[model samples]
Target: MIVFTLLGFMCATVVGIIRIRDLFSVVMLTGMFSLLGAAIYVVMDAVDVAFTEAAVGAGVSTVLMLGTLALTSREEKTTGSSRAVSGGLIALVTGVILIYGTLDMPSYGDPQSPIHNHVVPRYINQSPNEVGLPNVVTSVLASYRGYDTLGETFVIFTAAIGVIAIIGRGRRRRKKPEDQTEADT
Candidate 1:
């Protein structure tokens, strides 16, 4: 119940951030949203994921956003309510559809599922010898399917570098003041 409540509040806060015409409120809501996501990850027992969420999403992201706020406008001008209504309606429909799909998913930790009886055992036994590697996943990734995974990893690294470069201090440029009085001499 607490998890659900926090999640609901988080979602509402994200919505508020999008709708409210106040810069302070938006920043606060964004922080709240990040913290709530961290909390949800904790509740789900994803400790590693929760740690990253708390650090990157809750901590670093808040600081980055606040720094951006300091660099930009503080007050947000109101754009009226019709756009809000349209956005809310679309989001509501999407959420309902996602919930319905989630309801059809198999229960977690069910060992009796077909996954246990499938071709996993064959792969587990033959993977190391067939691919000439100890770690099955590594063998599958680097030996049998190296190029595809390398491309995916390269893409992620490229994206991460792009984001970091964007946030990093750019080249310092100095512009000389215009010579106005010299022409009058």
Candidate 2:
């Protein structure tokens, strides 16, 4: 019931964001959406993912978006009705296709799922022995999937650096009158 409520809130938030013309409201709603997603992750027994979502989605991303909004327009320009209709139609079709694609996927947590039958068992059985780590999860991620982890870290680092650079440039462009006078003098 709680999950359903959270999901309903998320859906409403998405609709609100889509309809909102105010950039600030959209950014705030985006943060709210992230928070709701984190709650859903918690309900789904994924505390690690929930923590990450809270930190990245609700925390860093919200701040960055607000910084961006400060540097840009507060109100979104209205597009042509034809363009809006076409774009919405495309989005609806894409969503339907995505939902259809998931229909064939195995039900979550099914023991007979191929993932549980094959890859997971290997990780659980062999990780400690092969990687020589007492923690199976650590061994699997740090040892077996080291490159994948490294790639993810590198991507995050790059994204953070990019955001910082963009925000810094925006700050520099907004010079105070006193600073401008000092420079002129």
Local distance difference test scores for all models: 0.76, 0.87
Clashes of 2: 0
Q: How much RMSD separates candidate 1 from the native structure?
A: 5.8
Misplaced by over 4 Å in model 2 are 79-82, 128-137, 160-185
Worst 10 residues of 1 by lDDT: 169-178
lDDT of 1 at 107: 75
Tell me how candidate 1 scores on lDDT. 0.76
Q: Which stretches of candidate 1 lie over 4 Å from their true place?
A: 107-185
What does candidate 2's lDDT look like per residue over 97-152, in tens digits? 99999898998667787777877888888876788877665776788889999999
Tens digit of per-residue lDDT, candidate 1, span 1-185:
87789878887887798778878778778878888888887887666667878888878878877888897888876656667778889989999999999796767657666785687686678986788766666666676678998899999899888876765533222112233345555
Error of 2 at 142 (Å): 2.0
Q: Candidate 1, after superposition: displacement of residue 34 in Å?
A: 1.4
Q: Indicate which candidate wins on TM-score.
A: 2
lDDT of 2: 0.87
